[model samples]
Target: MKPLVVLVGATASGKTGLSVELAQRLDGEVINGDSMQLYRGMDIGTAKITADETQGVPHHLFDILEVTEEASVVQYQALARQTIAAIRERGKTPILVGGSGLYLRAATDVIEFPPTDPGLRAQIEAELESEGTAVLREQLREADPESAAVIKDARRLVRALEVVRLTGRTFTSFLPQRNHLPSLEPVLQLGMKIERSLLHERIADRVHQMHSTGLLEEVRRLDAAGLRKGRTASAAIGYQQFLRVIDGVLTEEQAVEETIIATRKFARRQETWFRADARITWLDTACEQLIDQALEAVRG
Candidate 1:
């Protein structure tokens, strides 16, 4: 089997630009891994790559859903696998690119996710809405302490606990996905790296640029469509903070500052997520040699 070339990294780490170049070189089609980028009309906040940026190369799974729809790593895994298989059938490499570690990992790892209990799932969601995530975290800590320690967000923790609560099985039981095995296909995991200071600066600049491009208006459009800040649509970084500004809870300056800070924190969490995956080949964008090195690794 031919290898699937996966480009992973922290946010604003140059995955988009590099993947375009790699796809042009390798005759590959790019697949979206970033969760936020899947929503339509979320361009500015999500830092979605424009058609101009794609340089005529085909891109997949981006802007496929409306902001009101919920997307999960499980769904991404299924869709991405289908897309990759289709690309392979056409004799093209499937280049999975973005900073979303869970989506990327889920694509590669084949796990038998246990059956779900819809009623239990609904009950957990109701609990989450009524009791808040802290209570859910406590439940997760009690049921799946190992998973609880690793999961950072309340949303994720709650889901993990809900899985166990509904199925009476461990969350990890569905993971360490076998689908990602290298023996099944040639899999090359490339991680783009940047210096911390430089990454922070880039993040700030991007947030500023989003504002200049009318990120606030975009958020307003979504709000007018009946999307609320705490909803899944609001989970994307810039939109979340800017919604506060729109609601008059935060000043514009405060929103910008909060957006930058939140983005940096998210990047740190991304680093933590990818760091544990020993299969990744780290490429520093600051080094001109990185691309060639990655190309060589892929060709090997």
Candidate 2:
């Protein structure tokens, strides 16, 4: 089997451009692993690759969801695996690209997600609504410190607590192990490594560029299309800050500044998550001969 090629990195680390080049050279189809990029009309904030950027390569799993619909990792895993199999069967390399670590692992690794209980989930959600995320975060800290340490939002915290209550096991226990699943093909994981200071500067510039490119206009359009109704979409980095602008709580300048800060923090979290996986081959994205280096890594 042709090993699946995965390109992972923090936001603004230039994965899209390099992935397109690699796909062109390798005759590969790009499969998006970013969670937010799945939603349609989320182009600007998600930094989704444009048609021209794709360089005529076939891309899968992009713009697959409505803004109001929540994305599930379980569903994404099944879809991504199916896509990978079809691509391989067609004699095309499957290049998985994005910064979402869990989603990437879900697609390529032997991870089993826990079943959900609507009643229990509803109860936990109600508690979260009434008590706020702080209370549930503490509860999760006690039940599953590993999950709590990483999961920042109320929805995820509630889910983790629900899993703990329903299965009597820590949420982290259901995470992907170091070993690969026998049923799936092996993956060559490549991660983009950038200097922290340069990455921060890139993130700041990207945020400014997003604002300049009418990200607020995009947010306004999405909000009109029920963006706030979608839990996941509403909580996205740029969208949330812009939503605050819409709510009259923040000025546009404040929104822009806040978005930069939030993005920097998110990049840090992404780096921490991907760095924990020793299987990935880290490459310097800033190098002039990045494509050649990446190709050598794959071929070697």
Candidate 3:
């Protein structure tokens, strides 16, 4: 059997296509590591892989939550590891795929996440809204510069601060070190690499395609499903922007542009987050020999 193969990269970096190809070669099933993909009815906005895309390889941990629920990394850690074990039991390889850095690591690494205090988290979140992400990020910088430098958004920034307050330890302490030790078994982590300009083009095109293919409609359906009630699902990149369109605060054109910008920024953050790990073998996303290269990495 093959070792666990993890394909990670920025959004629109072609990780999904590479994943299916790799799974075919490795006789593996794909596991969802993207946090947003776990929610039901979050398909279009998350760019969720369709049944046709899976190409007969089984996928796990997708559409497992309602839009009204929040995603917890701790809960995901348990679910993902269980799924990984089950796949190994069937003698098939497990291909962990997506751009969610922390979730990916939590599945594959020896991370001891600190317990959360909801009251503390709520207070921090309130401060985040009132004082803004800049201020919360500044605090995180003072407390833990490592996490602050890598974290780009308000949500993660708030979590970082919350962990600091709850544990009196730096949030980065929970992050995997450079060694990238796998908790369960050996892992072959592959990061898809692409030129920044090409990635930017891909992001813009994807955002436009999402709008054309009914991202607003998906958001509307989820909105009626209590998307706003869920803290995490409602804040997803495409969904977040389109909700403005749903509110009449922004036109579809403006939402598309904003989604493109936010996605590009999120992609950059993903690149930075994954690049910091030295254990990941980089694969040129555009190369015709990509699958062979990954196989070589697997065998070697």
Candidate 4:
């Protein structure tokens, strides 16, 4: 079986187009590693590739969730591994592409994720809402000092609390996810790098294009589909802003500008996250022979 080839990059860095091109060249199947693209109705905001754009390359793990459903990284890891195996079974290489750093890492790394309990998760989420993340961070500091120090955000903090509460074990005890670890399988990880000014321009242009291309309409449709009920989907950059457009809060113009700013910051965070992993072979997206370079990286 062909070993996996994974692509990492920030939003609007040309990963989608390049993924399709590579799949065409390498006899590979494409898998969606982006967290937002998993939703069926999130196309315009997510820049989901169209069927026409695919040019007949098979894709997986996309459009598999309702807008109301939440996405789980642990579930994605299992499903992605199963998908990679299935693709290999049919004698094809698997090319995973996205800007989601954790999702990509989770899919490739040998992470023994802590167990989950939905009821406990709900209670913890309510505590987060009531007590705020700062207070929860204090509790986590007492419960698991190492994780409390390393884990940065509320989402991971919530999960860490869940693990500590559920099994009476520290989150750090379950897996070595804090650092770049070996993959369970042989794989090549490729990262896309772009000049910062050019990347900002790309993000601004993409968000403007999304605005002109009926992003609000798509969000309206998703709002009707209970997008706000899904914690992850609701907090997604554009959707959250446009759902406000539906609520008469942010005007379309304001939402577009906010989305652009938010996306640029998101791109920076993606850069920071992926840069920590020394395993990835970085590629300049502007290189004339990028596909060739990518192929060489895969083979080398």
Best-fitting candidate, scored by lDDT: 2
lDDT tens digits by residue: candidate 4, 1-300: 477999998899989888988898889999999999999989999999999999999999999899889898888998999999999999899999998877887888877777889999999999999989999999999999999999998898999999999999998898655455778778888999999999999999999999999999999898888898998999999999999989999999999999999999999999998888778899999999999999899888
Task: List candidate 3 stretches off by more than 4 Å.
Answer: 119-172, 180-183
Give the residue spans of candidate 4 off by over 4 A.
125-135, 149-156, 172-180
lDDT of 4 at 193: 90
- Candidate that would win on TM-score: 4
The lowest-lDDT stretch of 10 consecutive residues in candidate 3 is: 175-184
Candidate 3 root-mean-square deviation in Å: 3.1
lDDT of 3 by residue, 1-300 (tens): 458889999999998988899889888999999999999999988889999999998999999999899899999999999999999999999999999998999998888888888898899989987888888888999999999889988877888899998888998787667564655668889999999999999999988988889898899999999999998898899888889988889999999999888898899999999898888899987889988988899889
Evaluation by lDDT, superior candidate among 1 and 3: 3
Estimate every model's Cα lDDT from 0 to 1. 0.84, 0.92, 0.90, 0.91
The best-first sequence of candidates by lDDT reads: 2, 4, 3, 1
Tens digit per residue, CA lDDT, model 1, 74-191: 7888899999999999998899998877677778775565555667777888898899988888888888888878888766676687789777877876766322454335688899
lDDT of 2 by residue, 196-272 (tens): 99999999899899999999999999999999999899999999999999999999999999999999999999999
